[model samples]
Target chain A: MKLLPWDYGVRNLLRAPGRTALGAGGVALVTALLVTAAAFVRGMNGSLAETGGLRNVILLGAGSEDSVERSEVKAGVAGIVAASVPGIEERLGVPYVSPEINVALVVNVDGQERQASFRGVTDAAYLVHPQVRIVEGRAPRAGELLVGRFAAARLDVPDERLAVGRSVDIDGRPWTIAGRFEAPGTVLDAEIWCDAQELRVATRRETLSGIVLTLADDAQTDDLDLFTKQRLDLELVALPERGYYARLHDFLAPVRAMVWTTALLVAGAALLGGIDTMHASFAARIRELATLRALGFANGAIALSLVQEALLTAALGALVGAACVLPLDGLAVRVSMGAFGLRVDGTALALGLGAACGVGLLGSLPAAWRCLRMELVAALRAD
Target chain B: MSALVECRGLTRVYHKGDQEIRPLDELDLDVDEGTFTALMGPSGSGKTTLLNLVAGIDRATSGTLRVEGVELGALSNTELARWRAHTIGYVFQLYHLVPVLTAYENVELPLLLRDDTRRERHRKVAAALELVGLADRHDHFPRQLSGGQEQRVALARAIVTDPRIIVADEPTGDLDAAAADAILDLLGALRRELGKTLLMVTHDPRAAAHADRVIHLEKGRIVAAAAATS
Candidate 1:
């Protein structure tokens, strides 16, 4: 009671256990929605950003900077870039360059067709994209296919259907699934990877989609510029991988906006509901607050006590939201392009807690101010 | 003895849609230090209004009201609040002990405004609760106590600040005869033992018997003053 100790506010919250639970529940639900939406954007955009390493570069056909899937170069362009580009990173004497063929095709799953991306890669693809790791079985060889961990979800197929020893038909040709791979935070996790030659023969398209390369730490883009200039007949465009993904991220702005707008509206609705509830709760305590005021407590002190109570409730709500959201870390979420894992990292957790606190402060102060502004005698006389 | 409270032409007015209602009109009064005095009157006779003004919980619309030589009308709202914390102890008819707080916490409410350390607050709250004969029930909340016990707790809170003047508004109005006698006896003991000034407003004549002096009011004017036979 002295100085309205913090526990006084806390005990007041417990005085009406039902109301506290309802208020805290409302806050928790809103916070969960907020964290879920943010984790979704974080998972989607994070995949692209993580995949686009700063030192990596992509060589595509002329006039195809936007779509790596649609970009096409000659099948032999990988060797040409390895030889022409002087700073191509070397790993164990092998150049870190991968000539990949990306095919977006419809795959039949349980008699229904679902669109999926298939990438044609070789052993050097692993060196160029280190995020990709074979978590089960081994890498795909000729006549074999490797499915990403989240490929089943992206393809709308049963998880066990894409396991090792299963077969998937691509363009009327049955390909054996030899392994399962995981690319933790990349769009590639929603695709299948197979031998480039086998995919070329199966699709009967000999052209490669693009060539990805890792530049040496001390390397510069000037050499790649010169290479593109010298290979004018090849009709190639060299671009930094990060810049390419950055442009793609910009293209996905509308989708991110949609997600954010929906999330905020939900949170706003919850906030208004919470404010109304808190207003009623504090209104019922008008005489109590007036009594404190009569006992020499300043209006500011009583208001502080009210805010402290609200904040304590919100903190409890945040704790509940965190308990529900932290498990979402590493949970796979499928997107149109590929799949990425949801992550509730420290930043995401902090953001959720901050949003809950903001709701608490915004929800309680106005109600308290209105209640305290009443004349002390009138308030004390109120039932 | 010198007067602890002085009111010269003290008045309070309220307006209800252009209708002016004067609760206390040019009221002139004085309460000496260490004396027990009671103000009695019918409903709307300005007894509670005068008590509120003296307690510094309400402002006077016009005129001078002083407590311990500080003119209440001259002080700002904030300064008046500080003055009330340091100078006045008020007990309410409903025993307005915060339902959520224990007896000890209610008693310590006034002490929180002061710069007393935790140890000092504990000592004062213990002594005050002991003085009210509820020392063993310090941990009990208001709802846990009977009507008389709750009033005693409220009294403890009022006096815990060790203020110079104690003001009660119908302190024994809600109690039974035995409990009323106990409360009146305690109020009488406070004046005799601590040399404290007591000013109380009451409608019950038996409740006023413990006071040394009783003032009657009618329509915001002092109609008569008399000595208590008890």
Candidate 2:
């Protein structure tokens, strides 16, 4: 009556020295793989969700909702739209609309084709989106550029990484890493920032890559879309910050689903492997179980004990696997998003932990079921 | 007065494809409190089948069985299980001691079904082990023990719950004469010292000689009943 299902199962699993260890290791390996896959999916989707909201609108090449990089809007368009807009949100007595430009440059950093997105922004762009903060040195001067903390890591920029006055050449021109900033886990954390006009000229295809605007106190997000749709001279798209990320998440939804599905499928195999180990262990101890039954244990008690042992082993394996994936949290790595670099974040860690629990429970089921389903008389003599 | 074990007209049948066979036919048996009885027969003579039915481990094809006043034939699987745990303790020919468990753990397994504290369970396991003369070997794994020690551990496990009846099937089948005698002597002591009713199935005459009475079964019916003279 005092014995728990988990405790009994664990004891039974330990009955075989070699087989129990093998089952646990199998569960751990599969769990780790599951966590890692979930991490990647969460990392990518999270990075995408962090960028492009109503604060920013890409006036793409008419049909391209996919990127602002290929889009163009004249500097004159920003001024006209700002003045004509009746309900744009204002901050510090200035309209919170800023024009921006972007380019993905393949920099030869220590002999590798490292892909980095270099963004050019007007001073007011900081007001439109307020999350950015300079952590080291100062903001880029008109003549210099700034690199994010993660970008600094990827380029092996040293202890002087992203330090003021440190320089990295892009296309034979030295762009000084004038300052360092941290916007942890956002896609912006992997991009280089510089003066809009300079980048506009250097990468020159720009009328303006996109415009970002804040909502007026009285104006809701829906008004922006309605206004854009009603305009005859221009075609536009507008979405709220939450809505923008949701779209990005939807685009990458398959990756997330696959993370779970792959884990489940692989865990199915791992569960079978665990069952094999458990079966072998129980097979050898059948007589012992029968003897226990003979000693007055109810059949329910005996079956429960075996199931408990299997679950405990699997839960331990999951804990081990979660520990294995913990170190990958926020590691400096990049993936492509309209040629921009994206960062892994806290969301990835959560997904990894979730995957660990899933592997533990799902993988433990078959073995536990087999244990519980056994006939007491047969199981007792299994050895 | 309630008999610790009882069976009446117990008929157990076996079918092979379409061929029906009878293992136990119209058998009746009863063992009162503190009595030790040995049931003997050749293979296929339903000695083991009778033991199984009386122990509530198998269904009698047709008959009435009552162990401790609870009709075995009237209980469902779940109830039968409860009955088995509280009323009967079993010893198999193979000893069947779980290899992973220490002697104490093996003995404590039965108490898992009882409402007992860890202290109570430990006390019971210790006492059972002591009773079997293996208190010092309480932590030894089954593999670490000799055949006789293992059987004794099995015996300790059977009695730990203090069940009304101890049902043993070929309890000494694998032992030599000396080991077999030691086991029978233990059974004799169990009956005299603890007043635990004992029902054993065996082929060994020496083992049977330790019982207070002997019943001969042939083709599933009791053929003769003889008082123990040894």
Which one wins on DockQ? Answer: 1
Q: Per-residue lDDT tens digits of candidate 1, residues A234-306?
A: 8899999888988889999998999999988988887898789889999999988988888888888888899
TM-scores for candidates 1 onward, in order: 0.98, 0.86
Worst 10 residues of 1 chain A by lDDT: A1-10
TM-score for chain A in each prediction: 0.97, 0.83
- Indicate the residue-level lDDT of A381 in model 2: 50
Q: Write the per-residue lDDT of candidate 2 for residues A155-257, one digit (tens) a residue.
A: 5445364567866666767777778776654677777888888887777564877677876666755666666677746656654655555676787677668
lDDT of 1: 0.89
Best by lDDT: 1
**Which pairs of residues have clashing backbones in candidate 1?**
none
Residues B14-89 of candidate 2 have per-residue lDDT tens digits of: 8889998897988888878899999998888989878877777777788888877888888877677667778888
In candidate 2, stretches whose alpha carbon ends up further than 4 angstroms from where it belongs are: A1-7, A52-64, A81-94, A106-115, A150-172, A216-248, A254-261, A293-299, A338-383, B1-4, B16-21, B116-126, B176-178
Worst 10 residues of 1 chain B by lDDT: B75-84
